[model samples]
Target: MPSSGETTTLASGHVAVPLEEEDEKRIFRNFPTFTDGASRLNPGRWLLLKGFKDVADRIYNFKLRESDVVIVTFPKSGTTWSQEVVWSMLHDPDLKGAPRSPLMDRPPYLEMEVDQWPTEVKFFVPPLFQAMCPGGDASRGTVVQMLEVEKEPRVIKTHLPLSLLPRDTLDKAKVVYVARNPKDLVTSFYEFSRTIKRLQFQGSLAEFADHFMRDELRYCPYWEHLREAWQKRNHPNLHFIFFEDLKKDSVREYRKLAGFLGSKLSEEQLARVMEHTSFSSMKGRDEALGKSDQMNSEGSFFRSGQTGSWKQKLSHDLESKIDAWTKENVADFGSDFKYFIS
Candidate 1:
């Protein structure tokens, strides 16, 4: 529930999600020639996008407290995987596979809807995510909604770029931002856009790459998005991690995350979380596949969970274009962070 002065609940049952006038305009693309000036996202982007204009206001518009734990990412940048990691680390280490509760329940995607998801994937994915959660959605509310309401520390997820979300998401709470290589992100998003038809039909990978290089995808201006966060890397509460690094050293990333969260993990429990979340383990599995009930499997969320999958598909001209764009846009991002675009 939003505190006073922040939200307005409609008698019609429509949640008046809060937003500044500028943010409100982003929704126009959903209706007309909407473009955030990045790439146009596929319909899959709309899955959680529905309530952001209002429902999201039900959550994000409220003032944030220090205890809130949020995971922010540009779409297709291992947002889902980071959700799983935070969920596991924040809860009881003893609870293992087939959790006591669903994953979404514990630390739900502030935006993902489980009831609408397919039966198989949503049900199982929710559990792994939920086990870490103390009670789940029934008691609290949506992840962002709960974060707005709670004084205790909590874990939540978001795919909105920094500019679009309420500033409180940054100024007041702890932010865990994850990014993946653009080539990988491009390939993954192409697959993601197709999952939701509104993004555009799956054109040749070359066509998609052109859109990507041009920064026309949803939540795009990819380099700018990453750079915004990168500039804030020095924040004590901010943890910036890469998907490729997590792929190579899951435990290392886990430990780094735990340190930022101020949660301690035993070596064995750390190993278990890493092993369970491995890309190989998650691939084709019901949870990662997005085939389950939680989300529409139509466009597929887990697009080629491999790093270099781009090399096999991208051409030299496009690669150069991508390279040039990254240099112009991302040159200022910290050196510690490297993109897998090459």
Candidate 2:
């Protein structure tokens, strides 16, 4: 068995063995599990397998470069928000003016499953990226489009754990990891879990806590993934930003990001990015309301976009369990992570 902190060495030596567990394989076997059935609440019409499935092994794999930028974060942890921020930092001027690119194309999501829309909902989102940029380089491929890719100065997004990515991705690429308070994560996850295809029903909040505590969900054991990037925070090419930090001082946060990306923006440009990238403003835009990222979603992928929202939904009893579970599961157990907010 691999040690907790061990970096997996693949047969090729350079490649790494991704941290795959039984639950992930199980979820792979029975994907698109349910849609508003007894097992699900936030349901989708169709679910397609990207990784751990048939084609992605060859299709989704990509070789990143030193100039590439990757935004890594746990699911629903301000992924779209961070993507928007990073995109605007580099391309704000271009995006702000006419012939602009939507958030997706300028800085795309790298490895997660692409959400395709149903025919009914598809009409709402008009290829926000393809239309906005329409740059000659844009290729409309599946998750695999990035496979074997060697894009310089590229910016992409991903939700996969650090162990799964190519070893040099960070070494070669600028990596930005976004983390949120576990309470908010778990709070968002409860609703997001309702959308996942497989899992045993634990009950309302308490029921799910058991699975979460046990790390039963695919892309789970969130703390380990968090630490994987957290440990690398000091790396030359890495930056880890907290959701709370952005929530507290977004204007300043954008400036910090602009600086990281080697772009300097005036207060006016920063204000515009902050305005459009604001959750409420983006929510009003057609893209998010329609799952503009292309995952055939019926509802807003950016639904109720905010921080500390977990408080409204998580039970006190469940919260206690989650706090304990997070402490136990975090890689260094009281050393590496700051899971609580206030």
Candidate 3:
């Protein structure tokens, strides 16, 4: 609950409030002390990081067009990979029209408010990157603002759960939700939290895993998020993609994605997309675009994009704990769900 003077009214006439610390702890009893430069907000059933409170209402009410396509996923769940594949299929099927601009700008992240950070704490956005934003100045406009002015058939990206998005999101737009095994997702999120300056996470993987299992991380209650989408797995407008499946056979998964998005690419064109969206190619592009250099990251944005990489990272005890967590949570999803965790 937010007390008086603790809420801000956004320009959209939406009153936004971060959840009180007491409420947060009450809900996530095992909340840890690893401050990620943001508080938690339960705008609806989902828990989002602090910045989203400001624009959650705006996003929910924003008009969406039938031609629009949104890539939805939990963080570190191969979101960038899906974005690249979807964007390429829609905007650059021939592959020659692709821009050299960072993918962040191409299929802009709808909830990215990095530009709104206080000047002293803002992560460095290189001049070139800033220049490439929809407006020449990144600080001058929010990503949502950019999306508002974007042309039709827009390719939008977001980590917000389906419930937090526009009321008519599924009705008006095609959504591609990417899911990854919790084991790999948490491991990647741990590495990512350490790399991003904003998170300032100094904890070990085990500590991070504790936060994860306790549902204290941003966009957490991971099983619930997946379950929501999984239940709607038959929605006419929604498509599900698994990171492991993508890793197992990118060409096959990509072809399926292309078909779902109604893009009919020739085999040659499909091959071009496969090559461009490959992990190595994407890593090289990110490096060339300086994404890896930002936030004082010790590792590149694209680490080993391999299935089962978690075996190398998680200790036996942690693995057992995650396995039990997965088993308990996914039991309701039916045995078919085993394919994702397997």
Regions of candidate 2 where Cα sits further than 4 Å from its true position: 1-61, 98-106, 113-141, 144-152, 195-203, 287-299, 330-336, 340-342
| TM-score of candidate 1 versus the correct structure, residues matched by position | 0.69
**Tens digit per residue, CA lDDT, model 2, 1-342:** 321223322322222332334434433233243221111101110122222232223323466666677888877788878887776666554454633345555455554332322222321223543443444233344333433242345667777666655556766778888998877776566665444323222246665555556554545566766777787788877887888889898877788887887767888878888887898787777455345433333334556767777777877887777777765666463454567422
Best by TM-score: 3
Ranking by lDDT: 3, 1, 2
Give TM-scores for every candidate, taking all chains together and pairing residue i with residue i.
0.69, 0.70, 0.83
**What lDDT does the true structure give each of the candidates?**
0.58, 0.57, 0.72
* Decreasing TM-score order of the candidates: 3, 2, 1
CA error at residue 114 for candidate 2, angstroms: 8.2
Q: Candidate 1 at 104: error in angstroms?
A: 5.5
The per-prediction CA RMSD against the true structure, in angstroms, equals 8.5, 8.1, 4.4
Clashes of 1: 31
Instruction: Compare candidates 1 and 3 on lDDT and give the better one.
Output: 3
Stronger candidate by lDDT (1 vs 2):
1
Worst 10 residues of 3 by lDDT: 28-37
Q: Any runs in candidate 3 off by more than 4 Å, and if so which? A: 1-45, 114-141, 289-291, 339-342
Estimate candidate 3's alpha-carbon lDDT, on a 0 to 1 scale.
Answer: 0.72
